[model samples]
Target: MRINVLQHTPNEGPGSIQRWSQEHGHEMYIYHPYQFGNLPTSDQTDMLVILGGPMSPNDDLDWIEQERVLIRQLLADHKPIFGACYGAQQIAKTLGYAIKKAPHKEVGWAPVYLKSDIIPGIPEKLTALHWHEEMFEVPDQADLLFSSDLVKNQGFIMNGNVIGLQFHFEPEADNVREIAINDNQYPLEHNDLHQTGKEIIDHGVPTENKQVMYQLLDFMVKNS
Candidate 1:
């Protein structure tokens, strides 16, 4: 299978996703729509993974709209898609949901609780890395999957194939370090939900987090 990844920035690459794809013998291709506008057509991509970035989906940019068009086409074809953070917001916006400011700017590691058993094997409650100031409204047709204290709509699943998470589950230790370094100006002191750069980088990638990501990816492939 060909897994097309839409990477918005250099720091936010597909960390554990790449590992999962390779381990499962699936070919993965990454496209930088923001920088190069090299997104693949829906037919060329067997599955799609959208990575997070600092940019907002509401931005009036050509690449952002182009990416949304691709997402719409993929949904029409019933393609499996997994989106993280800003990518999640993009999916929500494409689904005609409102993307609004979060009550708090959640950064670093935060606990997220599973609200629905849409995907089995995911823990009822677990700490996941977060880095976002915007939140997506859960589409009416989608099942709300996860939530945090600060954000109500932490994740959602639609049509049994499209999954959107407003957190960082695909980043490994090295990937987390790179992301932290790139966004080193995070204001941890402003909120208790936020963590310092040192605190986040030191924890690296938790084993359980990686395991859950793998489980979700496996489920997507199974349904694909």
Candidate 2:
């Protein structure tokens, strides 16, 4: 399988998702729209993955709009897509769902409760990394997958092909630390979002939660 990853920032790269792809011997291509030009055609992609970032979908960036159009087209064609954090918000906004600021920012390792009807392969409770101030309304055409206290629409699945996750299912301990340290400004500026590097790392990776990441990738590969 050839997966095309839409990376929005340098700090938040593919992380575990990239590892999964390599472990399975799948080719991975990256489209950094912030640095590159327009996105490539969907025909060149077997699966589309939109990674997390600090930028919001509502930002005034020209590439953001272009990427949204590309994602909408991919969804229209029934191509498989996996989005994380801001990537998930972009997926919602492109599908005509609302994205806005949440009541509080969720910026640490938090437990997410999987829906009873959740894809059947995921565990009930898993601690996942989160770092977003905005959340999205569940698209009318999608199924809610999981939820956290701070964000009700933590994840959703559309047409059995597009999966949007508000939390960092791809996070490894190092990735979490790097993200926290690199993007410390936002957390430091907002009282509701402050967390030390030790606190974030101490939350650690749950074995069951890490398995969920593989389950998600397996599902996408089989479905695709």
Candidate 3:
């Protein structure tokens, strides 16, 4: 199977998702829509993974809107899509859902409670890295998969193939460090859900986090 990733920035790479694709012997490719404008068409890949970024889907940018159009094309083609953080917000916006400012800027390692059994192997709650100020609403007709104290709409799944997560389940240790070094200033503010740069970087990516991410990837392929 061909799996392609829409990477918004250099820091927010596919991380564990790429590892999963490699281990599963699937063809994986990453595209930088922000830098190169080389967005993939629906027929080019079987599954699409949209990685996180600092930009918002609401921003008035050409590439951002282009990505939304590509997402709609993928949806029309019935291809599976997995979105993370900003990518999740993009998917929600594309689906006519609103992206609102979160009550709190959730940053660091926090637990998200599973709200549905759409995918197996996910525990009741798991600690995942988060670094988003904006949150996506659960799209119409989509199942709310996970929620957190800081954000009510943490994740959602639509049509059993499209999933969106407001947190980082794909980041490995080096990915965390890279994101921390670049996007570290946001969490400097004191908040209940916020963690310092050192804390976030030191926490690393947990084994269970990677396990659940792999489960989601598998579920995407199996259901797609």
Residues 1-224 of candidate 2 have per-residue lDDT tens digits of 88999998888988888888999999999988888775878788788999988789989999999888888778777788999999999999998888999877888777798874647667788888878889999999888898987778899987777899998889777887778778776655563546665677677776665568878878866775
Candidate 3 per-residue lDDT, tens place, 6-101, comes to 998888899889999899998998899888988877788799899998889989999999889989999888899999999899999999989888
Q: For candidate 1, lDDT tens digit of each residue in 71-100?
A: 999999989999999989999999999999
Model 3 alpha-carbon miss at residue 162, Å? 0.6
Best by lDDT: 1
Q: Listing every candidate in turn, what is its Cα RMSD in Å to the true structure after a full C-alpha superposition?
A: 1.2, 1.6, 1.2
lDDT of 1 at 142: 95
In candidate 3, stretches whose alpha carbon ends up further than 4 angstroms from where it belongs are 190-192
Cα lDDT over the full model 1: 0.89
Once model 2 is optimally superposed onto the true structure by TM-score, how far is the C-alpha of residue 124 displaced, in angstroms?
Answer: 1.1
Candidate 3 lDDT at 223 equals 80
| Local distance difference test values of all predictions, in order | 0.89, 0.83, 0.89
Kindly report which residue stretches of model 2 are placed more than 4 angstroms away from their true locations once superposed: 116-118, 191-194
